[model samples]
Target: MEYFTELFFSGLTRGSIYALIALGYTMVYGIIGLINFAHGEIYMIGAFTSFVVATVLSIYGFPLLSIVLLAGLAAAVWSASYGYTVEKIAYRPLRHAPRLSALISAIGMSIFLQNYVLLAQSSEFQPFPELIPDFDFMEPFAHVVGSSDLVILLTTALVMVGLTMLIKFSRIGKAMRATSQDRTMAMLVGIDVNKVISVTFIIGSALAAIGGMLIASHIGQINFFIGFIAGIKAFTAAVLGGIGSIPGAVLGGFVLGLTESFATGYVSSDYEDVFAFTLLVLILIFKPAGLLGREAAEKV
Candidate 1:
């Protein structure tokens, strides 16, 4: 039972991270119908930004709490800027062009960011400071779940709730929904579709930034290539849950995380990727639209 509990929490933590990044992918796709492949690179940038800020603050003898807060803020702001810029430069021009053009541009941007980071920063992994302190209250369950895991789970829950509220009640949320339904119609109805798309990218990038910071802190090290694998998994999670559905993305993330966790625990860790991808394939075969995804008819 203790072992089971440990694996469960581990899976939950991993899922939370995946969900955060996946939200970025899903939101971009929902609004623009274009997959922002560069999103993973945005996440990588966030982790790097947080690492730099936290390291600098630590050197100056700032309090741990202050370091964490400032680092997270910096990561979000910088990542959002990158996301917005990517939208304008790489995607906006191809908005009315063939979907392939936008996809190619996204891929090119991802590659560019990865190589840029590698050249700017060393290719080796850098140690990430332990920003999240172990809480005294969590001592009892420390064996089953670490403080970082607890923090990740709680933080993800809060983020999800806050996101839900924003999309449901806020004016921008309404605009986002309108834009997603039909960009042309949204513009005709006096909604600023471009602004809505930009805002969606910003929110999604911010969320990814948070995930990047938390995961980097949890893992204790980061490299330029970390984003590639994480991004692929998150993208898989989004597709697994229904690419355009917010709730589905969350659900898919948790499910994928648990599957990977249990597979690693009961089986060999070497086959983890195999199992994860196999599950995705099986799910797609049975339900093409996704677990919570509804099929939509194309207008001719």
Candidate 2:
């Protein structure tokens, strides 16, 4: 029971990261049907940005919490800017082209961003500050929450709540929903489709950026390739949660996170990724749409 309990919380923390990144995948897909392969790269950029900020702040003798906060802010800004550029440069021009062309463009953009970062930051891992506290709250029960886990969980919760509010009550939120439902109709209704799309990218990127920052803080270092596997996992979570559903993404992320953690604990660590991908395949074959996903009827 104790082992299960530990695994559950651990999974939840990981799931939170996946959920944040999955939001970007689901949102962009909902609004424009683009995969935004470069989305992962944006996450990598955010982690690096936060790392740099934290390092600079540490040099100036900032408090630990302050350093993490400033790092998050820097990450969010960098992610938002990167997302805007990706949409503007890679996706916007291909809006009228064949869908395949847009997908290819996304791939190309992803490669370009990866190489750009490699050139800029190198392939070596850059260390992050020790902002996370090391105390375990449930030491008595042999249950413990590492500082990194706590930060990841808290950040994920705050971001999720804020996103719910943003989508539920805000003006841009409504516009986004309208655009997602029907782009042409949204344009006819004077919703400024392009602006909504841009905003969607910004929001998605910002969330992913925060996720990246938390991940870096938790892991204590990051590299240009950090986003690759994490992005894949998050995308899988999005698909598992019913691609365009916000809550679905969150649920899927949690599920996937727990599954991975449990696999690592029960099975060999080497088999962890294999188990995850195998589960993804099984879900696709059996559930098709996803755990929370519903099938859309064909329009007559």
Candidate 3:
């Protein structure tokens, strides 16, 4: 029972991280119908930003709480900037062009960012500082879950709730929904479609940044290539749930995380990726639209 509980919590923690990144993918796709493939690189940038900020702060004798907050803020700000720029430079131009063009651009951007980071920073993994402190209250459940895992789960839940409220009642949220439903009609109705898309990218990028920092802190190491694998998994999670559906992304993230966790615990860690991809393939085969995604008819 203890082992089972441990695996459950572990899976939940991993899922929370995946969901955070997956939200970025889903939001971008929902708003612009373009999969921002470079989003993973945005996440990697966030982690690097946080790492730099936190390390400098620590050296300067800053308090733990202050370092965490500042690092997260810096990560979000920088990541958001990169996301907005990517949209304008790589995606915006190809908006009206064939979807293939936009997709290729996205891929190129992803490759560019990855190589840029590799050249700027070492290709080797860097140790991430333990920004999250051990909580006294969590001592009792220490065997089943660590303080970082608890923090990740709680933080993810709060983020999800806040995002839900933003999308449901906020004015910008309404604009986003309008834009997603019909970009042409949204522009015709006086909505700034471009601004809405930019905002979506900003929000999604910020969320991914936060996720990157948290997971890096949890896992204790990071590298330029970390984003590639993490991004692929999160993208899989987004597709698994329903690419354009917010709730679906969250659901898919948790499901994928749990599957990986249980597979590692009972089966073999060597086949973790294999299981995740196999599950995605099976889901796609059975329900092409995804678990919560609805099929749409397009005019030819």
What is the C-alpha local distance difference test score of each model? 0.94, 0.88, 0.95
TM-score, prediction 3: 0.98
Evaluation by TM-score, superior candidate among 1 and 2: 1
> On residues 119-196, what C-alpha lDDT tens digit does candidate 3 reach at each position?
999989999999999899999999889999999999999999999999999999999999988899999999999999
- For residues 109-208, what per-residue lDDT tens digits would candidate 1 score against the true structure? 9999999999999899999999999999999999899999999999999999999999999999999988988889999999988899999999999999
Clashing pairs in model 2, backbone N/Cα/C closer than 3 A:
none
Each prediction's RMSD to truth: 0.8, 1.7, 1.0
Candidate 3: where is the Cα deviation over 4 Å?
none
Candidate 2 accuracy as TM-score:
0.95
Output the number of the TM-score-best candidate.
1
Model 3 — which ten-residue stretch has the worst lDDT?
290-299
Local distance difference test, candidate 3: 0.95
Ranking by lDDT: 3, 1, 2
Which segments of candidate 2 are over 4 A away from where they belong?
135-143
Ranking by TM-score: 1, 3, 2
- Evaluate model 1: give its lDDT: 0.94
